[model samples]
Target: MNKGKGRELRAMLRDWRAAAGVYASLQWRCFHQDGRFDPFLDPATQYRKDGAKVRAGIIRQIVLKHELDVPVPEPVKEGEKPKKRVLPTPPGLSDCLAPMKAALGAAQVQMVQGQVIGTLKSFISNRQNDFVDIVLGSTIDDLGRRQLFTINRATAWFDLGRSVKVETVEIPLSARLLARKIMSHILARHKKPSMKRIGMVVDKRVAELEESRSATSHDLWLKVTVKSGDHRSRRIAIPMRSNDYFSSRQGERKKTFQIIEDRETGRITVGVVTDVGSSFEERRMAYASRAQGPKALDFGLVTMFASDDGDLMGREFLRKLKSIDTTISGIARHVQRSGGKPRDSKRYVAHVTRLRGFITTELRRILNRFVAVRKPTTIFLERLNFQSPELSRRMNRILQNCGRGVLRAKLQALNEEFGVESHEVVSAYTSQTCSCCGYVDRRNRKAQAVFACRWCGRSLHADVNAARNIGSERFRSIGSARRVVRSNVLDMLVTQHVQRNTGERGAPADPRMSNPHFAAWADKARLSTKAA
Candidate 1:
């Protein structure tokens, strides 16, 4: 009876504390914005400010709220112009209170001041004598409302030496059957927008072009006009960069393309950069299997998905997202200059969304091809839980739009259909540890793309090295009570990796080696250890 009274008191205190916090926050905003010291104002303003400050201090004691660290932009160069400042406006009281309800919902936290609420009360009413406090909980109804105190935890003290027995229940699922079920569930539950829409858009654009130009011949090039001030203009040539990686002038122009001038404005115009879908297709095809692997009972596909500096693929994707962010900046600039509509983001947003869809879809398809070639595969993935402050807003946006969870769900569905398995393991130290020598140090990975081990003095591509560690890391087994931690076995494979690139000579190994395999590296490491 006393415990019940204590809970009611605490619940009332919590509500009062929340109300005080809301008022304090509003007062703080007012004082900070408009309540600054003004000699022209009345003396009463000073007293009111002092009282609000005291109230803010008192509310801080009762409320447990932590502020999020907001990111700031980098400083501009010395000669560059500074941006204009914008005035801040405080949100309404109801807007401030809405987040409290969301916070409570997420935590499944509730407080009831008086009597038990609903069906949960009935379940506990029968056992009321045995319990000191009866907690009630319920789901949100169709009316977008949930019962008060619908979720809760309680503290109760029992007589000494009293114990309860718990039973273990087995969920009946065979390895093959489980895989099949998982794959089926994913295929049914996960959905992606059709790519046919993009094709349709492209086809419609082509049809419009044909309708406007009846004299057009069978050619890849199309003419476009540019308008400017009235002045005669001449055609100029623009150069194209070379594709050879080893060429000194790789980024320099080796060939020039003809550019035409507009008759009306005399402004020089060039062809629009489009029809690059073929390039994406080529990149997608590169990830496909060259040859089929031997049939085995188990085939594992380890996916390394992370967004640290060491992640090359992540960094590359971030670069693409950053390029798109330039468009966002341009949009913002346009809005500021013209004082345009505030909510005009549909055009740029759609572009980014479409690009993200293409990238993620291509990634899934590539991974699926690898699985298809090697059936009965178990895919290893890193358990991603936290967000890193080191990631830029652009990088975070790319990751969010890419949808890692969606990819995992799709992989799970693959398991059901193709006997593929997906498993998650702790991601820590995977990028730092050397896969060949088990030598882990911060200096091993200094650059974004390079991993040079300090202890073994072996170097490899950072992403490939991290992927190797992920593929080799120990994982949880079915029916096992605890997760397994595998022992490090760094062996002669380090020597083999060096020799493979340097041809057994003492010279340094080449940084770029085709067909890097983690299993082969493991085998070499084991052999090297035995030879020693």
Candidate 2:
């Protein structure tokens, strides 16, 4: 297309987009006020054909109200068979939608209607559970990802060392003595002093000393140059931090860049947007071809991850998390007593950030280690619940929100990078179910760590046993176990156990009488028959 025609088409599309927005807004408002819109919010309504007529009626009402132009059935002659009646555009709203029709074609108008209906349904459904509001004029653009702008020619380079500044300040003997005294006092107060607390005290003192040298300490600025077309390059100087460095070290530039400013601190930063490489699928497929077998993983607060292969990872994860939680709780309590918001406290925010960082790092490390050691084609996991009686309620909430999402995200990355697929299984009684005999019982779990089956007499680590059950064929065959009640699941397991032991096709026998191996084992363990 020629430049003139291309520009005209672009302008036409822009106008159509605006008109579509207005049309959608009017429809949304109409639906929002209509009672019929509530029923479609039900998840099951989409699967039913009964709502089609109701929806069509609602659409007709909107068409009449907006005076929208719609297809009408033609009338037949007097001698011919009865024909469908046609409706005309209301004279009252004839000119109201003239601009909308002029800019949008039939297909585009239908697209706008569908988009508005879907959005309104979603909004109504979500508003029932959350605080939701309609945001008009925020339509999605059809531009390709990372192709919104065209980069004709540009050169980029990184200025890493040039952004760094180092300075030294002299400390008086009296200030050093006072700092040592404070450290000694802090050490004496606690049985096991935290290095973080001591470091904070020292940093405060150093900051005070540095403030005294403010006349010598000057501002550090970095210059950024930008050129457009034949215009001269414009240079801008931004205040720089000691560690600030360009992220694009390879001198790579993309089609887009953004300037971000921190609302609270008023700190400005530059961001470069880059596209993801297309080789991700190739890498994923390559890993899938090489990897073999499935691995089941049991998530826990103490051990982090337990595998069916009898491996435990991140054994000290709980200990480290607990330590961080202690600091966070302390800071929170102090803020509460002062009647200040926890977010307004710098120390509280810092500790929370640290806690999140630690959780992300540990989760990434454990998952990577598992993939490397197990080399599994597929990973089976259960819905993670990090609630621990040992941790504070706040800490548990944090774990549930941050840890679960971070772990899943890491798993997705692993899938894309290493072709490892992850699946979630129903975990109801896996911890109590014996992996060896398929026997399910609450008494099977003797302790938090130990799994001693009452029926099969099999003994093993509880998490490992659960992991084994999760990866077993029996568990996988029970499709949609999440919908089944726990009691029914237990009954199914009991029936399976009876069938396996007695080779019976009829009613299930007594669990004890069916398993001969359990009888022998029980006799050796000196268990009473009554107890069995």
Candidate 3:
């Protein structure tokens, strides 16, 4: 009795309720014709006119977003964008916006980048439990409509835990007008459209022209174009000191070019610089794969048939209904060992599509920021190899986790067409060897990230040393892992085996595969203790 009384007292004193992370696709119409600025949604068109159904959906999103502790998105202003300005929007909404951009970037993001976009499943935790979310926008629902909450429906699904499937529902509505409508209404609440609005808006105009720059050879200044077609380009400059590391000369037609080299070791390492005219197979593959949608699964009917009056009329009446019906349905993923994979992903199709959308969009953003070339520069990376007897299962799993194969595939295609990646080989002790003291000791690496040399007391990031060795170091002529530059027993066999199989002589895939220098690098760094 006392415990129950205490609980009742606690419930009566709570202040805030749950939070909402509402997500709605944003669309901006260039009201100015010159693409100078995008206006918020037109209230007269969205709320005060024919798009009544669309307005209600937007309102419901608003209520749910608030419930998730996420503040409502402000309207898009005349000159400002939501993503750049919303640097400080509440955390939940910001996170939700990320996957949405990945999943759907004005439909234009999907067409340009041939990859999967992830879903936008926002999380809304309870800040306080005092009250439940009220869905009618700024106004209470009518008595009949209010009952919709008591019986489980759309509103209740938001409360499901992390794994529940909540995706972008294509309601046969226009995201453009819907976005504008939502933005307009939010702006109205502020009396004036503030600068901090539409933090999630992806201007379609900006989306379309961004890929055009990929056509340039990465040897000049990288431009960050904002408000495209309106002639606004914000270029970020990367200075390549034109020395041995970055040098250039005229070709047959006086075409100036530059070679990029290592900063410390003075070795030439190439960077991403694709030819504008080259048709990269990577892009082709991306376009091809984009045609193949997510692997699907199908499920049988799960719910009892409902009557016209909302009454359940079937054998499952005695059982409690699932709070969420058909939210995350799929065929093969959910199928048991005894049950074969489903032929189609009829149930959770929306979720898969949304998730893929998110991934592809994020990838596009990464590409936009890092994939650049002005001077034919180079970067040295240790060769990645998983097909080896030395690799443990967990180590293999970690390599897979890095998605090296996929990443390589992407870069390979890009480089082949553009000639951007000009990787070279130093073939030295990449691991178990110290770049500074020519020490090699497998035990020198006490941790995955840390490497300490016993002979010289020089420590380095294990991976960094490995990358540097593949660029500048040379053959030590020893066939061991105990020196700064030595070859491994595995390396010896691999070079020969590779030659025999492919008739092409190359060390292991790692640039340091059979480099002569690191023969004793590992022995020099070998842990006096036994190999762990």
Which is the leading candidate under lDDT?
2
Candidate with maximal TM-score:
2
Give the least accurate 10-residue stretch of model 2, judged by summed lDDT. Answer: 148-157
Residue runs of model 1 more than 4 Å from their true location after superposition: 1-316, 336-343, 373-376, 384-395, 473-532
The alpha-carbon deviation from the true structure for residue 138 of candidate 1, after best TM-score superposition, in angstroms, is 27
What tens digits encode model 1's per-residue C-alpha lDDT throughout 1-532?
1344334323423433353344334433443343211223222344455555554544443332332243222334699654333323222312444444343221111221011122223333323322211111113232211111111111111111222111332212232232233233433453422211110011111211212223333223222111112322222112222234323321222122223333223233333223334443453354333323222111111222421212322334444555656675566567667877423556545655565675577557655655555432355556543223444565455555456665766776565444455666445556667777665455678887678985467787776676566555321221111122222212233333455543322235322222133445445655775788
Better of 1 and 2 by TM-score: 2
Models sorted by lDDT, best on top: 2, 1, 3
List residue ranges in candidate 3 displaced over 4 A: 1-334, 342-376, 385-409, 412-418, 424-429, 475-532
Provide the RMSD of all predictions against the true structure, rounded to 1 decimal: 27.0, 24.0, 30.6
What is the per-residue lDDT of model 2 for residues 1-532, given as tens digits with 9 covering 90 to 100? 2354334333433444464455555554444243223322322233243345444545655655566688322323478753223334322222334454445443344444444455555544433222111111113132311111110000000111111111233333333333234333433453421111110001111111111223333333333332222433333333333223343222333534333333334234444434434556666666677676899999998888999999998889989988988988998999999999888988787778778888999999888888877789999888788789999999998888888889879988787677788887778789878899888767678888999986657899998999999899877766543344555566677668656765322343345543443454335334453455
Q: How many angstroms is residue 188 displaced in model 3 relative to the true structure, after the best TM-score fit?
A: 69
Better candidate by lDDT, 1 or 3: 1
Native-to-model Cα distance after best TM-score fit, residue 479 in candidate 1, in Å: 13
Clashing pairs in 2: none
Using all chains and alpha carbons, the TM-scores for the candidates as numbered come to 0.33, 0.52, 0.25
Tell me how many clashing residue pairs each candidate has: 11, 0, 85
